[model samples]
Target: MRWMSTVPASDCGRAGTKSSEARLQVDAWVAKRGGERAMAVRARARLVELVAYARTRSPYYRHLYRGLPSKVTELAALPVTDKSQLMAAFDDWVTDPAITLERARAFAEDPALIGRPFGGHYSLSTTSGTTGKRGIFLHDARQWAVTSAMATRMLTGWLTVRDTARIAACGGRTALVVPDDAHVGGAVMAARLRGRSRVAALSVHRPLEELVEALNDLRPAVLAPSASLGVLLAGQAEAGRLRIAPALVCLGAEGLPMAEHARIGRALAGAKVRATYNANECPFLSYSCPAGWLHVNADWAIVEPVDERYRPVPPGEASHTVLLTNLANRIQPILRYDLGDAVTVRPDPCPCGTPGPALRVQGRAADRLTIPGADGTPVTMATRPVAIVLDTVPGLDLFQIVQTGPATLRLRLAPAPGIDPDDLWDTVRARLSGLLVRRHLGHVRLERASERPQISTGGKIRPFIPATTSAKP
Candidate 1:
């Protein structure tokens, strides 16, 4: 494909010249008519432009919209796509012919390619593959710029000039706690920031003591981590084990329970706790307003809440799933893509004064498992690693790991078509056993489930479920 460098001279921080320009433009967009009417008008126009471009450049879209009208005005008339369908037609799905799935997979697999632009042209990221199949997403130069600009705007919204100056005085370093996996979105973004600014991309896979030590040494001005990890570290901070006073604590990737948010807030009394809603599919999907409502960036993206049958859901009601359309990304046309997260759009305007429909997301909920440590004390094993292991495995369809007991794990698998169940079970058991052993839970037992796993009433599959309180490690 075209591996051209699209990053501006200044890409990351609000202080950079290019970042300042982006901030100005984004500010202008928001300032016009309080950003409501202006954003809607612009989004409609951009959606039309993007649809026409996708039809002309993408073979998959061209065929998908074969008989559609030349001047389409309605978005619901278009077809909806999911991860499996898009990945199955990867070559034709992309606007560019040279960007094949094979090349993209290789690029994503290599640890050396982390943080660097793929083929020196597109910024690439992939989903966790927790739900069965992984999705590889690409962004051309223009799209990447938009992502950076939007991020800068979001960060600015959370931190004021005084906050920024205070952070800079305290070393200006950002500690990003994410999985070490090279292909994940958090790692890719962390690596890119590390290359450009004073940032430490700390892996969540590291031991708790080691992570705390590293954070203590870094004394970062900003701390970013998944919601689960943030809650764990908050406990550490409360116990005086992990000590760092960050100006801002940004949490993403997974949903943050209100209790956990309050606990973290209590632990870090002076820090600003900001929770955001985003994914690999569209990093700038939405940002949390001061009142803790997620406001969509309608100027650059569209989120359509829908029912189970793909029909549009009304405001104030929870959707079965949301359709995400990234207006900024041209290389990969993410038009009407089904993002499995359920969300609710506020019928009224946000009290925070943001000029768009506020959203409440019901995202993934994977519980952490506690197992006996070397000293027989409870050791918490975050579900992220388990998810990574399962996500990377091929030929596996729907699966779940339930911690029936302190040291017992029951695995439920729904294998892909033509796959031998016995062989798949053996492979999964071995890998899982090895991972548990490496994490110091060597005594844990793995057993195949005699019964099939059931999806929740909400139609969500949780990969990790902790044992009962009586069975605590």
Candidate 2:
């Protein structure tokens, strides 16, 4: 939810749509070239410009690159930047000198400032820290407008003429199931689509019954939700409880299993499901294709799927982690930035025939937990609500909740630097226990584990380990 871009209520100005159209046309032209080398050439040129601008503006980059050559034309020439490294130099990482970490932190945390721009020009957003490294991102109006336009392009690609007619008949209403508090994305989408369509915002944290009822009432023509929420709603529809028939169901924030996506698609009366690959740092990364690959927008951004030692991994092989470079956003230059996610770049061009690069996501997450209620019925919990409860716990970014038993659960945490482990545990226990009590899940035992969060087969930390699975991750 906080991962989505928020444009101003003024629709990012009238020029926004025109600029978007222009970007779309440029992207189309690049794709038509249908050559990876061509896309790489453009990305390399942009990388040179971005590197020059970042070195001149950002003190952090200037210091890091002080030993570098006068001209950096190759992507591999620059050093890799990680979250910890960049965040440590927070005050100087951004190109803008006026945007301080303290004020940006305060702005992103305030619910009242969710949709509002910072300094009346930049929009503030925070990442959920799925990889155990939370991040705060700032985008200028032009950057956000690019995000908004890219999003529009993605949706337009997904929707068919029949889908468009259906949406129009349904009053052009769109429903967004996003994080309740840190939902800057939902508000921005609503404001951006104003007059053209009505976007109803719903929380992913709401109880299953409540969420279903809300959807039924809204009866939205277009629906976008986290993967877990969509699956739960699919279950309700399978039981003949939920009856709304949407024209499309776009998945974001989390991953959806193929079986679940198929089931949900059938249950939702064949609404097409499109999963997007984006982040707070790079909002217009890639969009999923029916062929199951995410086509990277190489003209505007660069992704290097690399090995453990920062070496480029061969095609068809999964990389230890991927690096992202956002060329469209010069205010906060993200150049060869370490994005901690496992991915595999395809050896062959996509069958969908889109130009540039395509890849498979190795660590797309799905956080869903179901427990039996006091009345013998099951209670379902998704990522957003659980993230709201646990992500706020100070000194805790790397933690895992494993359902050890029908009612017993294990909580493993890795405290941040300088944080008292015992103190962090005590605070997290209290917060989680309170949530359980409120949700009538107090009977579920919360066990404190001596072990830290386990590394998954994909080499990332799994946030929630379901009871149905006996193995870790």
| Residue ranges of candidate 2 with Cα displaced over 4 Å | 1-38, 183-197, 394-397, 414-440, 448-459, 470-473
The TM-score measured for candidate 1 stands at 0.88
Candidate 1 regions exceeding 4 Å error are: 1-33, 394-398, 413-434, 449-460, 468-473
lDDT of 1 by residue, 2-44 (tens): 0111222133212235655465355434533356776776677
TM-score of each: 0.88, 0.87
* TM-score leader: 1
lDDT of 2 at 231: 79
**Of the candidates shown, which would achieve the greatest lDDT relative to the real structure?**
1
Backbone N/Cα/C clashes per model: 3, 0
Could you give candidate 2's per-residue lDDT for residues 370-433 as a string of tens digits? 7777786676766456666666565676778898876677998888789999899899889888
- Candidate 2 TM-score, true structure as reference: 0.87
